[model samples]
Target: MAGKSSAGRTRAARRARWWQLTQRWRMVGVFEINTGHEFYSLTSMMKEGMQACIQATSNTESQNSLTDEHFKTKGTQLLEGFEMHTFAAPVFATLRHSLDISEQEFMNSLCPRANYLQFISNSKSKADFFLTYDKRFFLKTQSKREVRFLLSNLRRYMDHLEKYPHSLLVRFLGVYKIVIPNQLKKYFIVMQSVFYPDERINNRYDIKGCEVGRWTDPETGGKQVVKVLKDNNFKEQSIVLGPEKSWFERQVKADTAFLQDLNVLDYSLLLAQQPLHQDELKGKHSFADLVIRTTKSLDIEDYPTHLEPSSVPLLRSRSEEVPDGAVCVPGQHQAAAEGDGEEILAQEINSPAKDTRCPVELQGFHKHHQRLLPNLKNAVHVIDGLEWRYFVGIVDIFTVYSIKKKLENLWKNLRYPGRVFSTVRPTKYSQRFCRWIHEHTQ
Candidate 1:
């Protein structure tokens, strides 16, 4: 009986060892299967002539660059032994059953940094075999430095690949350095869409190409046709400027008369060329307006002096109640009480003033009302420098209102670097301009 029991124990131990070995081999097989799929996808793509685009830069130049002769001869010998096999079916089945990734998603996963590196590294052996067998793959892969950068910045490359799978690999690589500007451009586009309150300009005006004209009050059955005079007598318009014959001076004089006749609110003329309706012009009631007419040939120095800063208030009151979702100053509380003010006040204070400047007395307004200043900062950063320059004159007025409201709400929590009045004045204009730019650029 004792002998039989000992034999039974030995048999059970042998079965346990066999199970362990099987499990070990199973895991190894899984790794190889995954690695093999990556290899097959890369080779297939390469053979099909789907070239990866790469951007070049001077900084990437190597001092000790190798000539083609150094690698080509040896690379050719290595290409003879490699073989290309299709694994689309097995790869698809494995992804479905094991990785649980759809075939499309699995393909997309190949785009980002980490996956790209893994794809390249896992296939190195196969690539080496191809190099030994055919040599072409080696020559193509070795021809560029960007391929190395893609391999090196694998993690970032992978994250971006997933986020922008459709983007070219070369552009994907450039994103590491240019991401801030690119993201800023995208954010500006989104903010413009939000702020501009898209007016159907097509419905309001007859703007064929660049010439603008519209029948005023068409919907109300009135015919007040506003038309700009055509520039007739082309030769007389083109006369060179001199003491007695300054054609530019004459045009400025004519333009001033034309603008005055229109009675466009002073600053409204700055944006007159913009496809805005009359009602939109009326919306600028919260701020003072300026009008200037300059000929194409007139230098900026020749422009007339703008209104004195002292004439404008440090803080201008809104003509209407603060819109819902707009951040406001304490002075606006009276206006807020008149509308759905509760909703604006109910918003949790998470952001700060869009304008960094706010008076001490007004600083507490944003804290009390719940504003998000960080978000406002982020929004301001979205405008491109070039776009800002193009609309610099008009943006001054719009940013002032936007900044003042933003500061008024976040007055308690905000701080600035200069005198309250000085900081407030310029900041007001900047905020208004940025806000307007944020709107129109979209």
Candidate 2:
């Protein structure tokens, strides 16, 4: 019994040490980011690609419209045994700038002082996700076809964002490609995290306004805390919106229309729920102020960035099999580690002047809410009666209604007649999605 107890204590100590070294960092199996072993070895290709892309963005001049040259501006770099390719470097750079993410801030967020990139497990999509230490942005692995579609519709998407600056659509910050020694290729698209405000989200749902297969299994029960509930799992609640309601309703309509025009489908409104504190409900603290305070509250000195293990460890081999699960599912095991290094909020200083060219509805909406940060005001909806603060954004906008989707939709409809599957035609899908959102939010 004494020996068994000793073994248990030893295991506990090792676990504590791991958490200290990683500051509660979570990874897939044994995958981890160690500077000594990984900085110049496993992840070197990605680091080199990012550095090259940042430099290309720094050198390129901003353009209102993309030209053939912009798409052709391929910056290639040859690292140890890997080849890194950046697609439309200047064009993505302009997108980053337009979002007010400066080059320095961008570089810092991706390649932080800790040199750690946490792997997100079991993404429902075909792609894998890797989050930065600060969690400001995450890299989603994409298919070559998806990349092509995005580039083709790049101009229209940019125009939409420019016109409807407050659009709740997910922001794609950058795109990249890496070729391994065997000539196998990997594509990555970096996107701003919708829930990056560092708020404590109690619940999350991917609402598509569809009913079939949208409900969570009753067996999960309390375990749902780690899972993202779907449309059917969502409870119907009356949500009260401030003046921002007009802006949100209008933007959703416009954004969905934009997606329909691009033939994009299978997107959903990603919603997160945060239970409000008594002080927050009483207006002692505005949600905006809480977000800002939470962001700046983290003192960098508290978490020293230079800690390293006594010796370099072997790198974990990359698994070719794509994990099957939801995006960024904070599994029960990772609960403790998920909160350690939450966010290092990127403050946007010297923001561009508001465009007076906005339509009267947008102008009126901006007048009242402009005082709050754009992201804060746009993303948050506090319902005092419900005692919940809701964070929402439109996500998974890449799936296009191509020939493959058409066939899939047809097959599904035949299999389950009168059932709403997510793979419908773009126009009808967007209309249903918008209408569902309108009805649910009301």
Candidate 3:
């Protein structure tokens, strides 16, 4: 009787597998009547956009990587007469090349194989965040106003990327539009995810540095879930960048300078913390296999096997084409080890010119580690919460100086009396933000 029951369970599992094999995969989205046109049309457009990106960044035409010989926008004109724009190869070639993202990988991230898409929603905004199956690029719904702002400043942005191909400025891959017959045109912007799908970040914060309107909304669950937090939350726990503190501070100065000059404001500094030496700090045996533990920390078990960069045809094609002497591989380890990066770090940090570019994210492809060690420099280890590293970048930079901001200022002023908030004019906000960061870093 027990043998018969076991055989019956085996049969049920086999049947489930067979059914799954026959059904293929389902595409998810917000649609009205279940017309399959959305999947077909959008996927095809994304493919075209990918091809264009490949052509733009092809090394056959220009031996120099990301060096624009003669630049042109990469896009596709759909059957419906509307067009979609995406990062074609030549547009930000050096930038993409530096990030080790190939055109095929980029396209796959944005369009993906029809079934490899997952729908995600944001409660704070009308826009929805759609993550590709691989979790490389974040496809976010955008408003016409925001789209226009992006389009208008795109050239300047391209120039910025070109100058500092590896810079940590919010990497915007493409902007796409879909005409919905009777409805308004749907627009989407593809951006790089701050947190890697493989890595685990125990502590994260969306810091605006401003006291006013920076706190996470009270209604949203705090710490229990991912919430955009602000100055007060950050102040509760101090940050120390250790020996590289000076380097980190300088990088922020350079980044903020570019942002301020552009009149871009209201962006948040996204911070992620990764604890190191947990066993040692907790006074446990260090014999618990460090290699295995580290391996598990950056594991990508959740993603499908096909998502690896090497497996993608586009990445494979362009993989060998990375230019010699390129700064794609990080060279910070030796310098950080020797305790002799002040001059070099100074150049990186002090350069506020548009032509200069640097990536200030948690870099190191092999290590991909943040330069920020614990706050051990100023306080005692037991009392100072000093067993972690940090990753930070200024993100959500689409908002530009506009009439909307002016109106917002008027509204905020009326809403909150005897207080100035982050809603200040672009010039004023930039000054405050940069000043605050400088002071805090010091």
Candidate 4:
């Protein structure tokens, strides 16, 4: 009973007082797959601790009263207090229950280490953005208006997903709220990161196809980190989708229908290019492989370390509490393993670099030092004279054509001399965006 339920917030919600928290945009965390390093929030650490304390108190207080069926039906309670609401999604809940993992394991994946959410110096969105430690997830600040909009259309969105399971829209996994005693409430929407773990993106662009605020000149103010260049910048690179161009266009059309139907706009075709130097992709003995070598040296965290001290006690023997018909299990999940465990571990860690090389076969490389791109045999595709796989996702879909955006556009129009701003009407924006993508998608 610590945190107010989403139901409670929905009951008391109104527009006027809650729209004040859209000031600074601070981003949190990132996860690197190759290195297995991830950014996690300390507040997440705090939440886990607080959740453990609460669960312990609840268990002790209820004792024999809370039966297995009762606990199973009610679900495990996490942190709660104040007027805000936060809880894991059904997918997470089912996964935890099915796997028989401690609640802390799920929490760790959501918010791992004590990594700080850094401010994205180049961001144009009003909401703060944070990347997870492994960069597989993004945590962003949300405004009251947007949250309400999403809540209103939540069912429609769910139905759409149920209809088209593989729709390219950014996977919206979870939504949450944080309310402090006296401040405006903090809202967060957690999303699945579009890119994959093993891929190294060399050239990336956030293509809105809008002329206004889309361009990030090399001469721009802040130092360039991982640059989210504009449409113009993207065009300059002339990186075409190549043989997969047709497939991409089909995907765009499918995704466009979904967004346009929902009146969603200001979204971008986020494209990341991982130019796998033919040599690097098949680089068996090259120095570029050192990054992977060093990554392997580091001690990777298999589970959230923060939960170890106190949570160890809370995780009572699983077998002792099993119901009459239940099965006893061991290892990571409540499942039995087959085959050599060592082989499975090695396959996961030492997955062959190309078709040829394995970690076991890798020596200090005093013998062979050749560009191995030509020698390795595997699936191949050439894009603009270079072979690469483009990881594409439609992001920033939460921006609705609200009254605030309308006013902002009006002000921008008056503020600027002639042409209406790039952040124009949502319909026009989406049209222009999709058109530009179609035109340049060679």
Best by TM-score: 2
- 193-307, model 1: which lDDT tens digit per residue? 1111112111111111111121133232232222222212111221111111111111222222222222211121111122334643353222332111111111234222362
User: For residues 1-442, what per-residue lDDT tens digits would candidate 2 score against the true structure?
Assistant: 9999999999999999977866532332123467664333535567666876686557556676777788667777776677778777777778776666788888887765555454432236756666666767878788888888888787787777766554678888788888887766888888887766434766667888788778875344423124567888775653344323334544566677788778788888877777777866566244455445333322224323453322111111112211232111111211111111321111111111122122222222243222122224223222222356667788888888889999998899899898887888777776677656555553
Cα lDDT tens digits, model 3, 280-364, are 4554212233233323323335323655655322223321422332232244422111121212333333323222122222222
Clashes of each: 42, 0, 9, 19
How close to the true structure is residue 103 of candidate 3, measured as C-alpha lDDT?
60
User: How much is the lDDT of residue 300 in candidate 2?
Assistant: 26
Q: Candidate 1, which ten residues in sequence have the lowest lDDT sum?
A: 185-194
lDDT by residue (34-83, candidate 4, tens digit) is 22323233245334543453344322322222233422221233444444
C-alpha displacement of 435 in model 3, angstroms? 3.8
The CA lDDT of each predicted structure is: 0.24, 0.60, 0.50, 0.46
Q: Assess every candidate by TM-score.
A: 0.15, 0.68, 0.59, 0.54
Distance from true location, Cα of 322 in model 3, Å: 35
- Assess candidate 3 and give its lDDT: 0.50
Per-residue error (Å), model 1, residue 135: 30
What is model 3's C-alpha RMSD?
13.0
Q: Which ten residues in a row have the lowest lDDT in candidate 4?
A: 363-372
| TM-score pick, better of 1 and 4 | 4
RMSD of 4: 21.1
